[model samples]
Target: MKHLFSVLCISAGSILSLSAQQTQKPILYGRNWMAITGKPLAATAGAMTFQKGGNAVDAACAMLAATCTMWDTLSWGGETQALIYNPKTKKVIAINAMGVAPTGATIEFFKSKGYNFPPEYGPLAATTPGTPGGLIYMLVNYGKLSLKQVLEPAMKMAAGYPIEAQAANSIEKGKEHINQWPYSKKVFLTHPGEKREAPEAGEIFVQKDLLATLTKMVEAESKALKQGKTRKEALMAAYDRFYKGDIAKEFVRGAQEQGGLITMKDLANWKPLQEEPLQVNYKGIDVFKLQQWTQGPVMLQALNILENFDLKGMGYNSPKYIHTLYQAMNLSFADRDFYYGDPTTMPKGPIQGLLSKDYAKERAKLIQYDKNNTNIGPGNPYPFEGKTNPYLNLLQQRGYEMDTTKRNFAPKHDLGKINTSSDDVYQERLLLGTTSIEAADKEGWVVSVTPSGGWLPACIAGETGIGMSQRMQSFVLDSALNPFNVLAPGKRPRVTLSPSMALKDGKPFLASAVQGGDTQDQNLLQFFLNVTEFGMNVQQATEAANINTNQLWLSLGGTKTEDRMPKPGQILLNNNTPSATREALQEMGYILSFGARTSGPINAIYFDWKHGSLWGGSSNHGEDYGIGW
Candidate 1:
């Protein structure tokens, strides 16, 4: 019997190669340390603070204080932005711990109260929270721990834990604004007798006034390390008991009982700055980000106009590599909406001619490749800095038209069936709310933060459970073509919390992040071109299938007809892509829609360096995790 049909065809080809390696989604190995967050108990409290030795900035500020007590759509009176790196000062930095505006938040005090925009939630969209002075300034400069031991796992999970189901559906969609604020309905609802709801997801969700305001800043850094002081003067006496004592007079009495404009000298002239990180390079890696008040140089000007094309011979997520990455993310978000802002009030030829490379080779000769174009704009990076396009006479005195047959639009706010852990209707339509974290170790160190504004136009400041940041609803009240994101008074607002890192030939190599809001660097530039041009691995480059560019321009803050363009042949994609690349991007004219999980989960790691190993991943789309051995 011819050797019994070659042993049953080699045992049916080893059971179809072990069922295609058990349907492919593994990639999470580790050797020394790793962490990917957006919950799973804050990536097991950053792999138990790197197995108790703590490094990658004290396991990313102990997984950002255990994701501010297991995520309530990212808070602890939100705002964090990181990058870190520092393999013994081979340097990287850029923390910024974003949060400013409120020297009495101007713009003529919300246009003399007529308020065209910038009051998304309350206390005049509060600021000055700065995630506990940017997590105690990364635990008193590159942590070793102690801010009472990296906030003892967020004060033991805010004294309780258990609340999940997407943070009990964002406290049941901010339960009517936490029943109109009685200290945000006694710390985010769950009464019992007066029958309040939301706290079900396996119950137990306590807050005990955010563990008594993180136990009064860990007993003001353990009474200044028992009067002996010195762990940087006991973390500056717990950062002057949260910005100049008594939690800055309870954030100026919850911004003067809600008609807010923060003070106590805007929480004693807030801090968290530290700079140096807007890098670029690409292919050979480098990357970094945060500066130009973030929209992070629209992924290094869309990876310098997709490095003059040929994206791995146009394949991965092909449709001519997602229409040349939607024409280099609509020409790097039309130069990030006419030159990004707040580099000290914009305009010095917008970030040296929108991060030149001969202005990205003249914006990569206006990307074409078989058309799907949308009459993109914002270029003339100030004629490569020799000046002029100073917002071209305010985009022709604000006419800034487009039309392109009304770009075939939608999303004027549907938030595509919510729950990517609450951006409460995109922060009550002021847009961009986020969450992210990434870490690495084995001493080569790495980081990638991204916490975000307090949840959906949140407020809570008084009793100190602390949930302020409506990141001043991302500024802009259009003081003439939005100066560089207008509305000042202690400036800073022009955020969309971007957090990425990379390096490769020089070390680190990838540390990604995400949480939409103008699709955070278009989902970290399609997960860094799906791991540098389709090699795919941080879990198949964040589980592949992406695409976003609803024709750029919308970094949130409104007026100019609630700006955020995207219509000229719309393009969301993502419903598990590939139906022949969605009919080749609808035969290259674009228009598609598909929705749900619109490319914003990510949370990466990578490293590898010839098998030194790390490799992590996340993106199951939402309650992401991805820990490591």
Candidate 2:
């Protein structure tokens, strides 16, 4: 494996000045290809694929597979979402690899069981695994390599890889849950019996069960090829082995034993959707994301609202700038909470109205420049369609009342004197257990993907080494009022796994993604603005201080009584942000919480139009790494 600091340094006489390196965040520069991922090993896997003549899609799949093994918070059985930009077609494709509820899942099912909402963990929360199917789909349709070839690296890592400190910490946090399930304990703990604990960082952690499972699929593919099946046919056979063959049987048996609802039919019928990407034009640059099912559209709506402001004049991370950004996010998130859902169940209004420039102009008027507004709510988007949201009253009734005083905003990290002892002043660093990868080849093909689920608190299938996803928890149980995200069989719960792509002058310009659940789109928007509006390179943009609003509806299941509103005058800022700016914001009536960390580790690759080279950047805040050659 390649070292994290290893880079193919370009010669001194390049378009970019070498002197600037000392001042700016380090960025990996390469003439042919680049891969930025959540882990150095994963990036190295992708780079190896690229070196072996694979395209960007192939490299991305390889990297994602390796990431699933190395990142304890991610699993092969989790959900995967991606956006692929093919320069040859001048188009971007959205891959909705998120899983849906089983046929047995329904509001009444949970109601009869005396549950208000779906469980946050265990087999009951599991949806059909989509990552495997999604990976196979990408490989068969767009990749230049076989499934066996791409999965080899992942199998090797799963057998025994050097554990990192973060992964060990995550394992420790979920130790109790893993201990309850024998399969999970066997795979994640240093010992399955008493004295079990998270392995030490740099210790060789072996996942023999996971390796056996992956090897089985590879063998299945090889058997199909030996039987005279075509490459695509062999790939499909291997995919079926996970969803419709022995793996599916094991999942069904485990769920049945554990009182869960998933069945073989659900797995057999599941298929990842390939759809047109939702897009909005910003300053002549086209930004694309997944559909309304995700919080992706919130970023677009916020961008539309922000376009009306001269953000550059406000200064980056300045009080006014941050305020404006948060306000836009608040409005968009308000709308998202009230309306965003699966396309099949979305309200009557066309989604286009939400993205329209005209609607953005109207919504922009809600921004109050002189003071912060805490009582902001979703606008009348239906008015544009000559209708009203009939369920608005029910939404308001169910909404958690805004109580800023009760909201918590303390730093989770113990940053010496900056840390506070007050419970309300402290906040937990939210880890959603997700990973992202970006790959770009010399051919101009770019791929960005976010894979999640089956992390800590996940239920491992019986002897399969597959951790089931808890994505079903994203759905609301209200059958009457929660029309969009209401629990239903065959319905995909609204998710936060958003991957993004951007184009400039009809050419591929950017591919980026982050792993911060509800904060994914919010942080991604900041990165985009840092580059487009502030003229920062990939590295500088990634390393910049980021802010997240708690005012939006919580995506994960948590205490129902907690206030779901953004604390009035309260925003989170990393300690790296200037103290002067923090004081200014505090004086402006904005409560500030300082932490030593950013919202997420955003991995991205930028296509330098002038230089015709790829510049890649990854966050140093986490295990992220960037490699190019």
Candidate 3:
């Protein structure tokens, strides 16, 4: 009887443990994954291929190619960046397809033109285009399907497909820019009369030029291999066909006449930046990121800081949690401003402080109990081993609030709800919310990049596709402060495209990228918190309602800096948000910014081992859909 009792106890314990594990398992699974994008037709087609047993790479290739036809703003001539994780090799790879300034372009040239470099000058300040070369690299290296096979879906979509609501909406928002390009306008717009235009919704949009481009890409490998060239040689030959051959020469000549800077040599010398992936650890999980030239590292640094906190105890979307997040954001942005640049050019600066575990902990210490603290300072990296300055002392002083007996973890107050508007920022309070994670692996890595040109040269003026990047405008132009961000040739700009990833048990579990210019870090930080600390599923994490703090934008880059913290403590909120949340946020000392039209789409994917499947979601705000089979 004693032995039997012992056996029953042991059995009960085992059952309880298994049940706990099962509860923790993430819902949604598939060996293969599909995601819907803001661009529905493109996402739908990609989903179809996944249903046909294609991998992420194959799906990505098809989606990207198809997007050129569907999304005029995002095209083949634009840059491409991705971070990929390979489960087989337990590694991550980073790819930089960001374009560079042309050799002859000078700051003096723009100054001479009496232009102070606006935020987005597209064709006028164009750099070398990189997507075509990028596609070749992704297909030949990471993908399982042949170029032709991956491209089949894209070609079909280009030939004819009903325009999705999201795609149509995007086109409507960017219609002026689309119409600005004569070739683009001819292919996409339906300007039937003075005030009337063809409806993009449910209409068939064709891209004969893009289809021709894809056809050529497919032929290059086949024709070159027939001539006995190696794969690398054949690929290079294809690249030439893009930028140095007949199509390229015409493009260059047309662009030159329109005051564009790209030269034959710039195209010839242009090559994607390839390097090993950047990595850090969080709660025994290895977090991987791209280097600093893009803002991927910024997200990694923010996550590193949050790790020192008992974030789970803070509860989801609580006022305390959100406020603390904003504080951390301020600290991260401060570090980003002081450091974080092209490592080769800047060399051993403040960025090290940004990502150091000790520094992150110290910074985490600054979170306060009840006030909105935007003036947070930076934490030193080299201080005392095993821990950093701010967090350790702060945690000690705060008395480990995570201890259940001392405090309740749920949100204390209901601010109203989060809302949106197109005119200006509105403040509302609601609940808390959160891409696809960029994948890292043996074959190659995918990187998330936001390569924007503030000053675009006119493509219609025969500038071909050449345009200056508007990224420089992200820097503060004020001579009194932020002298480093002053516009100059070869000066990398401050950015918010925070591409980020996470690892579980030292292996890659999630990799995602985002493209919101001002909202990037805020979105990434919250999304990651949902997955790691809040214990939410990938879809839940991605779908959570998130607020944009815009630390750098508020302090340095936005249209109204002074109005960020409104007078009399009244803040604007997204009109779509609940009034109660807005009132609460205002009472708490926040000013709101609102806009119905949002920034770039946020994209993400995660692997759930418990269910033995993958889960993915795109921005609900975007017209794009998330697809998985």
Candidate 4:
């Protein structure tokens, strides 16, 4: 009887494992791709478009439109940086819709206002919004479906849709912010006398104004078409409705009343800056990225640095793996702070010399296996700078260096000084001890991004709930010498948004971006390492144990990380991390602090031409969902 019971138990275990495997369902379709976002409805919308015979670009358009109404963190009012891989042309094109400083913005004007860069320099700090322009560009250049058709899903959702877990959470958390703006509050809040009546987990919230805005856009497009205007011309007319017509006027009035500096000219004169995407060749794969304004180069530098070592040998999620990745991130961030900026405005090559292949190789040589305290600034590899290919360097070179100089890793100051109290040496030792790290598997797609402009106080005031751009908050106020980065008009703030893409066998595979302030790169790096090096599926890759070492300390989250998280410094390890690995890290003199770290939600679409599939992944930490059919 005992023997029979043991056999039955083993059989049951086998059946359970098989069930788990089967539950890991695959989204399959012909002439159909799959996409996953943080929102199920949004994913369904994209899938519906795919089912309607729209290609990737069309699906992208439809999904984005829906997201504008469905997700508050993303909207038509925001900006976008995208990379579209067109197999037909055998080329990858990038679109940077990142806004620019208004024409009237100037350092001198800001100085005269008796304000240093305070993270909220009013309208003078607001850049010309480029999202609408960028979408228009995508529709004009890449979209096959008419603008009307592409916007249908978003319009439908905007008209009315049930709020799901993600949307409800956003509403609940952003209550203060939503209530602050009359229009915003109207769209999100339940009704009069119901200040806290947020939608339940599966209730409904409607954005009537957004729906109305969409209606106006559709009408504007119709009017333009009747006048025999081109599609681009029609879109431009719609843009004017928001920027030059009543919307623009209202926004301007609000800014003026609120002591903000936005003007009608700022909106009317706004244009998307056309530039080339930066590219790098890593291990026979061509990686492409947006320029400095988004911090895309740092990833290229880090990957290049990693290429020098055999990461596979280090073992997945081991102390060695985490150590190497953190070191690479720290080094790349150092370069990001010091030399990265709008290249066009800077001399022909500010850090062009630093991002070269030779420089990356040289930087990679500095990775010490055992030593901690190994800090090096960026190196200028002048001779290896590549040709400028649609790359727009959008940072002010004069003040750019100042921001970099004051960065926490700039040799003198201790990163721990700002937040964690552990000494630098102690932190390094602690890092060496923590283990059980796993890399995301490279399923069918890859994402690389460099989203920038987070310098001072997150400016968000006036103009239909428009807040000041987060770029203004990049500075730390009381610096005795070289005290800049205080939110100032015309002063472009520091940014960490890096536009990114991955390639396999010299072909473009994935293009993506995320919105974490500083942790974007860390997230992307981990994902990239997981997929390409560790070989995990997309979901597992995204869900794997991940640690974010933004500066000196590390925070864990995700499938693997979350389990052991909430474990404080010196807390017991109740995780699958190998005892050997933990011992190794502890031996390195590290103190473990288990908690959640924010690495803004990541977004990307992958093209697996060989398999005739395209896959996309969105951030688990965000309200966005991944949908692909």
The prediction achieving the highest TM-score against the true structure is 2
Give me the overall lDDT of model 3. Answer: 0.53
Please identify which of the two predictions, 1 or 2, would achieve the higher TM-score against the true structure. Answer: 2
Per-model TM-score on C-alpha atoms: 0.35, 0.89, 0.76, 0.76
lDDT of 1 by residue, 1-629 (tens): 33322321232222222112221357788888888888888788877777778876787787888777665666777788798888897778888877778776777778787666576676777777787888888878887878766777778888888878877777777688767777776666775344446677878778887788788888988888888878878887878888888877886787688677777877778788888888889767889898878788888988877887767654555566677787888778766665676675434326767877788877787666666666666666776778766455665454443332443433232112212233333333322547788887787778888887777426687888777877776777775535677777777777878888888778888888887677778878888887777666677677666877656545554543434344555676777774755665666677676666666688888888887988887877777786787
TM-score, predicted candidate 3 vs. hidden true structure: 0.76
User: Candidate 4's residue-wise lDDT over 1-629, tens digit each?
Assistant: 34322321222222222113221233222234654443567666666766676666666666656655555444555555666565656565666666655544555555565544432323444565555666667667766566677788888887678866655665666676556555444555674466445676656565565666667767887899899998878877877787788767766775556455667887786666656777777677687777665567778888888888777656556566666676676677656654454454432334576666677776676555543333344443444665442222222221122233353333343223332343443332222110000001122222222222211112233334333343333332223211222223333334455556767775666555655545566666776776677655444444445665534212111112112111122321225555555555455433444433233355555556687666555545555455544
Native-to-model Cα distance after best TM-score fit, residue 115 in candidate 1, in Å? 24
| Candidate 3, 395-429: lDDT as tens digits | 32323242323433211111223333322332211
- Please state every model's RMSD to the true fold in angstroms: 22.0, 7.9, 10.0, 9.8
Candidate 4: give its CA RMSD in angstroms.
Answer: 9.8
Counting clashing residue pairs in each candidate, in order, gives 3, 3, 97, 74
TM-score, candidate number 2: 0.89
At residue 422, candidate 4 shows an lDDT of: 31
The runs of at least 3 residues in candidate 2 whose Cα sits more than 4 Å from the true structure, single-residue gaps closed, are 1-25, 112-114, 192-196, 345-350, 385-388, 395-431, 479-482, 559-568, 576-580
Question: What lDDT does each candidate get?
Answer: 0.72, 0.77, 0.53, 0.52
Q: Model 4, stretches more than 4 Å misplaced?
A: 1-31, 103-126, 191-197, 347-349, 380-410, 413-471, 474-494, 512-515, 552-576, 589-591, 596-610, 615-624
